[model samples]
Target: MPAADWRASRLVPRRAAVSRAQVETVAGRALGAFGLVFGAQTVPTAVDQARFMADGSGVAMMAVVYGAIAALAAATFTRVAVRAAALAFAAIYVIALLAWPFLVVDAAGMAGRTPWLYYLCTVATTAAVIALPVAPAAAYTSAVPAIYGVVRLSPSGGGASALIAVLDTMYAVILGIVVLVIITMLRQAAIAVDAAQEAALERYDAVARRHATEIERVKVDALVHDSVLTTLLSAAASRTPAERALAARMAADAVRRLDEAAVEVPGLDDRVALTVLTRRLRGGVAGFSAPFIVRVDGTDGVELPVEAIDALSSAAMQAMVNSVQHADGPIGRVRRELEVRGVGAGGCVIRVIDNGSGFDPAAVPPSRLGLRVSIEERMVNEGGSARVESVPGEGTTVTLAWPAGVEGSGE
Candidate 1:
């Protein structure tokens, strides 16, 4: 890669790393508030005590400015950025002292009393900022030094300020804790919502399955009654060679038409029982379809919400029709291995394996009407998926994963 291109690529990874670190820091800070408060407070104290602040007013003013900058950084903060900014404040405090050597502190004279009002206001502001439910950690960082003073320093006629400082420090801690609680609750709520969404998708797939089955049954019944039997009877009755030949041809055409017409269904929800589904499907096929060797595995006692059940079932029916139409090479084709297994609490997989010419799934975007209506959309709606794998002149496998999670429909 060119120099500029390589530079950009390197920067991208660095930025991503930085972003991830920030997120981790934020999560850690929330869980470890006491540690964060203690660690953050040490910075300002170290700065104030450093030789750079011996000139007093100049260093104090610089600290004030740095504190404001820290507050801004905290207000619009990311996890890593805020921590860096906090340390940056400490670094700035030091740099300001070092860059302007004239303002160096004189320890003996540096013990002058800071205004009581200054500590009170700064501490209160820090508490209020950090107390905001979503406020970042840096908001209250400036108060760390004041908090340290209340607990550490005690005095004579200059002592009332320390008492107020102690109160302020307690408020800051309480405020930070409150924010942490709020964030934790919000996070839990988000997780619940995600679970709910997954559940909804499964239910959707189940419903689709039920409806598809009902429609296919009606079509099968119609085709067998109106077309299949009528043609076969005519073929039998024909006396002449040409009459029998035409009758045989008509019978074949009717059978083909019947298979394609069988996509309609009666309405059903996602909660239909699997045993009931298999029975119903077998009945619809009657004697026209091949005998199915259904070996249900792993469904010891697992079940899913009604909607999810419906979705997977619908996808299964669609896959079956596809097998009948596309998998069979000529007649009496042996497309075996139809299995449904429950995956977990609220998940299952429907797989149909067929020995026939398998087309490139990528080259074909599911041109079959059943594929669009019953498989792809149905699986996705359930937060699951459908995969079709096949090689030319080889077999095809259709797998539909129902999803995982319980919803309002939980048993």
Candidate 2:
């Protein structure tokens, strides 16, 4: 894809799909709220019946049962157990609504004194609508009221007339339908917002990675110009066999540096023994004209991520190469050392030390890729660090350490 098209595609926002469980939770909460309100409205009727009854109980007990169901639905919506419990409570609600007349005394005389009890059908239907599938919700919401209306509006029944009973029942049914529609829309909206946020984050990450890659490419080009290209030109201009030989070595060193750059620290999860890393470092410097000694401490049973190994080994080799090419003392007399130390905390420390004339590290220009890109940047990229210490007439020590242990080592 073209850059502009790719950018637009990634940046464009879209709606996310809502999960069934979330919809169920929202529906459960809404139904639970309605049930609580309906139950509260029945309180006065419950108190009145309790006062008049010989045992001070009857319809009032039924109100308590309904309230308990509402509370249980509300509480379990956030729990995993709600799936089964919610359906069970909804079944009890539908049965109670259908059996309303049988459960109460003076059903006809009670009349409008308990309008809220009729509305409880709305509460139960809405709960079912939230917790149950479409087919079952439609069946229960429509069936319970259809049965109640028949029993309520019959000629023998002394409650409300047909028109009034139908209107009252319609009030609950229509409200339930409206609430269901609103819940559906809200659930869809929630999903859309979530999708948009995720897309935005992914796009931001992709852009960041592209920018970093471009910057590194420029740095590598500068490195080649300063090191490899310079050595090649010097080789072409040499006047003597000795000068040509030295230039050839420099050009070969430059080529090797480029090749080494291709060997990056493996992913944070890969493991390599410390002994293996030390061997690799020695192998990289085998062509050095000077004496190079490698010392190991605490390498037993120590393993690190591949990336950590790559960074430390490459940096150490670079330090040794610098000693071979620039150290002012006699090649036979000077002692160059590379030490690998492992911390019990799964950390590794590598130091390259040499007793030869050294230049101030600060004097190295920004254009020098050997120290900046090869040593420091490589280490820093892998959660490790490299520090160079040197002064006039004193040898240099390049220290590389990963204090956080190997990446993804579970340390």
Q: What's each prediction's clash count?
A: 27, 3
TM-score winner: 2
Per-residue alpha-carbon lDDT of candidate 1 for residues 7-96, written as tens digits (9 for 90 to 100)? 110111111111222223344344234323443554564455444343465547545644645453453232223334444444443343
Candidate 2 lDDT over residue span 1-411, tens digit each: 123321110112223234333455556665566667777787676555433333423555565557566655555443334446556666776565555555455554455444334646676677666667666777777776766676566422236787977876677678767766776677667456445533543454345445545655776787699888899899889999999998989988888877755443234675767776765655554434445666666677888886677667667766765665455453254567876777663678877888766668888999988789988898899889888888755777888888534422322
Taken over the whole model, the C-alpha lDDT of each candidate is: 0.50, 0.63
**TM-score, structure 1 vs. true:** 0.34
User: Of the candidates shown, which would achieve the greatest lDDT relative to the real structure?
Assistant: 2
- Candidate 2 Cα misplacement greater than 4 A, ranges: 1-30, 46-57, 60-64, 73-80, 83-85, 103-108, 111-116, 155-158, 198-219, 237-243, 265-411
lDDT of 1: 0.50
